[model samples]
Target: MTSHGTTTEECSPTPPTAEPATPSPGLYNADLAPTARKGRTWRSYSIFTLWANDVHSLGNYAFAIGLFALGLGGWQILLALGLGGVFLFLLLNLSGFMGEKTGVPFPVMSRIAFGIRGAQIPALVRGAVAVAWFGIQTYLASVVLRVLIVAVAPGTASWDTNRFLGLSTLGWISFLALWAVQMVIVSYGMELIRKYEAFAGPIILITMASLAIWMFGKAGGSIAWSTPATKTGFDMWRQIVGGASLWVAIYGTFVLNFCDFTRNAVSRRAIVRGNFFGIPLNMLLFGAIVVVLAGAQFKIDGKVIESPADIVKTVPDTFLLVLACLALLVLTVAVNLMANFVAPIYALSNLFPRVLDFRRAGLVSGVVGLVILPWNMYNSPAVISYFLGGLGALLGPLFGIVMADYWLVRRSRVDVPSLYSDRPGGPYHYARGVNVRAVVALVPTAAAALLMAFVPAFHAVSDFSWFIGAGLGVVVYLLVADRKGPFAEASGEAIAVPSKR
Candidate 1:
C-alpha cells in the first residue's frame, strides 16, 4: 500500500543530494545548514576541547561536589562517575553520528524526523532550551566574578543587601562584566570558540590541579570521602543512581545538540576517540580534583565547599587567590562562549535566515538571557534541579525520536534535497508538512517525563526521567509511523552516507 503519495518500494532508494551550499535569500541561511565544505583538519583534541568547554565550569564543579554528598565514599563515587561518563559518551556519539554522516546541523538534520516546515517545532523548543541554559550558565559563570569583586573592594559586600532584581549591585556589575567578555568572545565567532576551548581547557585543568594540590597540602595529610548520610544497601544504590542522573543532567544539554560540532569533525573515529578522552576519562580526572577540593574544605573550614570562588577565598596567600580568580574568570568565559553561545546562533538563524546571522542571534540570545532573571532562579538547589531535569525531560523525547527515525525507520537514508523542500509530495512534507506520528509520540512521553520532574510524589523516580521519556518516544514513534513515510526502510539496509558535499 502507498503512504503519503509514495509506495513502499519507491521510498527505500538512496536519498538525493541537498541544495547548493549557498542559501537562498528568503529563508535559507548559510550558517543554518552544512555547506559544500569537505573534510576537516580537526583531531581528537578538538573533541577534548569541546568537552572542556562544556564541563570546566562552576556548574559542573558544583555538580561534582554534590555527588560526594550522596553517601558514597571517594572510591565508590569515582566508580559511579566512570560508569555515568561511559554512558554519556555513548549517548553523545549517537547524535554526533548523524551530523557526521549527513553534513547537516541538528535542525536541518531534524527535518527528516519532523518534516521541513514541521522541523520548526523541535528547533524552537531546542532553541528555547539553549536560551534557558545560556542564561543559567552565564549566571553561574558570574559567581566567580561576584566573589572576586567583593574580595578586592571589601565594601562591595554591602551591595548584597542593596540589590537589583535580587542580584547585588556588585553582582549585576560582575555578571554584566563577564557577560560582556563572553559576547566579545562570541563576536570573534566559532574559530575563536574552538581556539579558546583548546587553549583554555588545559589552563582550567591546570588551575583545578593546582587548587587540588594546594588543598591536599593543607588538608593535613591523608584524604578520604565522608558524608553525613548513612547509606548502605538500596540507599547507596539510590545515591549512585542520583549521582548518575546528575552526571547525565550535567551533559544532557549537549546530547541532542552535539551535531553542532560533529558535523564539522575530521572523522567519526576522531569523534569517538575525543569523547573517550574528553568525557569519561576527563570526568575521572576532573572529579578527582573536585573530590580532593571538597575533602580539603571539610578539613580546613569544617564544611564542604562547592563554589570554586568560595574555596579560593579561603586561601591566605594573596597571589594564589588572585590567580585562582583570574583562572576562573577565563574558564567561565570560555565555557559561556562554547556551549551556550554557538547553539542559539544556529537555532535563531534557522528561524530568520534572511534577517539574522550568528552574531546578531548571539546578541539577541544574551538579551533573552538577561530577561529571564536567571539570577533569581539559579541560586536555589530546587530550582537548579527543576531547571536541568525539566529541560532534560523535554530534550529526551526530541533526541529519541530523531535517533529512532534516522537509525531505525529511515535506515540512515536521509533524502538531503527533501530536507529543504516543503512541497506536498516531498519526502519529509508529511501530513500537512509535519510528522504527526513523531509529535504524538513526543507529547505523551515528554509529559510523563515532566511529571516525574516537577511533581512532589514522583520525585523518587526522577533520576530516570530522561531515559523513561526517550525510551517511550522511540518505541511509540516506530510503532505509529507509516512504513512508506519518511520512516520507510528496507530490511538489512543502511543509509548510504554521501561524502562531504
Candidate 2:
C-alpha cells in the first residue's frame, strides 16, 4: 500500500503487539506500534460511550445553550447541529482511517503530512490548545464541587469568600484536589481511561436524562425554548450559521485526533459504529436534553441559566441535589482528562520522545496549564472568543492537509519506519525535515481564517473558517504537490473518497 512521494512504502503484515495485563513503560519503542498495544480491541459500544462522555459535559451543555441564544428557533438550531455533526463525522472517519491503516496516534500519523520533523508544528498547536482547555475544564469541574460542598455543609461557605490569585480559597483547594485525582487515573494509562469512561459515561447520561425529566415536571410539563435576554439583534439565518459554527469549532479539534482511541478498535466496523452512535446520534440526543433543561430553567427563573451550578441551586431535595452535583463534577473531570489532557500529553511527548516520556510530558503540560490561570482566561468573553476562535481556524486546515496528503496525495500507504527515522530519502523526509508545501498552504490559509475571526467586518465569515481553511489548504496542497498523476497510481483502490453530502 505504498503511495506517491519518496516516502511511500508498504506496511509489513506484522500483527500489533498484545496489550499487557500490567502497565508497561509508556514511551515510544521503535519496534512497537506507535501508539497502540498489539491485541486489545476497543468494542464499538465502548467507543460510543466515549462520545457519550464527551458530549455529556458542562462545556458541551453551555455550547448547546449558547446556540439557542443565536436567534434561531428550536428546529433551526437542530438543523445546524445536525449539519455540523455530519461534517465532523466525515472528517473523523477520514482521520480514523489513517489510524486503522497505520495503527498510529494522531500526532504520530501527522508526520505523514507535516514531515517527520514538521509534524511537531500541528502537534504543538493542538497540544497547547488542549492544555488551556484542560485547565479550564478542571476549574469548571471544581465549581460543581464548590456547589456540592455548600449544599451539604453550609458552614464551609466562608471558604468561598477568601480570594487568592482571582480564585477563592475553596476554589483553589477543589481545583488541586480534582487535578490530583485525574492525574492518578491518567498515570495508570489508557486502559484505566477506557475503564473510567465506560463507567462514567453511562452515569452522566442517566443523570442528564433525570435532570431533563425533572425540569419538564417542574416547568408544568412543558418546556419553552427561547433566547436569553442578554442577546440582542437576533437574526434566524445568523443564528443557524452561528450554531453550526460553534459545533464545528468544538468537534473539529478532536475529529482529526479521535484515532488516538479508535485505532485500538478490533476493526474499522467498530470505529464506524462507534462514530455513528457517538457524533450525530449522541450529540443530538444530548443537545436536546440540554436545551430542554435550560429552557425549563429560563421559564422558571425568568432568566436563561448557562451554568449547571445554577440548575443544581434550584433543586429542592438536598440529598439528591448533592448527589447530582457530585456526579456532574466527576463527569466534568472525566471528560477533561480524556479529551483535553491526553491530547496535549501525546502531542508534546512526540517532540522530545527520548527525554520526555508520556507521564513527564503530561506533568509539564499540567504545570503550564496552571501557570496560564484559566479562570482569568474565561473572564472576558471578547478575549476568550479571539483566543479560541484563532485556534479554531487552525483545526480545519490541519485536518484538510493531513487527510489530503494521506488519502489523495500520498495514498493509503505510510512508511512506519521513516516516521521515527532521521535518515535522508526516507518517505516523510523533506528539506530540513519539514514539508514546505504543507507550510505554504497551512500558513496563509490559517492566517486568512484568523483575520476573519478578529476583524469585525469579516465576522460573518468566521463561522465557516474551518471549512474555509480546509478547502483552501486542500486546493493549495494539491497544486503545490503537482504530482497528480502519481497520486492516483499510489492511492490505488484503497482511497475512500468522502462523499460531500
Off by over 4 Å in 2: 1-38, 225-235, 380-383, 482-501
| lDDT against the true structure, each candidate | 0.72, 0.72
lDDT of 1 by residue, 1-501 (tens): 222223223543543344322223533555664533244444689888878756668878777777676567776677778878988999987877666655567778777888766777777777777777778777876777777766677787888677778887777887888778777777766666777788888888889888889879887865657766637888888888777766786566688878877766766777888998999998888778877888777767667676677778777876677778888888877776766767777778877777887788888988898888887766777776776557657887887888898878877776554565556666677888788888888888888878987888998877777777778879988888775643432211122222222
- TM-score versus the correct structure, for each prediction: 0.88, 0.88
Can you write out model 2's per-residue Cα lDDT over 3-51, one digit (the tens) per residue? Answer: 2111112333433223211111332432123433335457777788888
Give the distance in Å from residue 333's predicted Cα in candidate 1 to where it truly belongs. 1.9
Model 1 lDDT on a 0 to 1 scale: 0.72
Write out the backbone clash pairs for model 2.
7-427, 16-38, 17-38
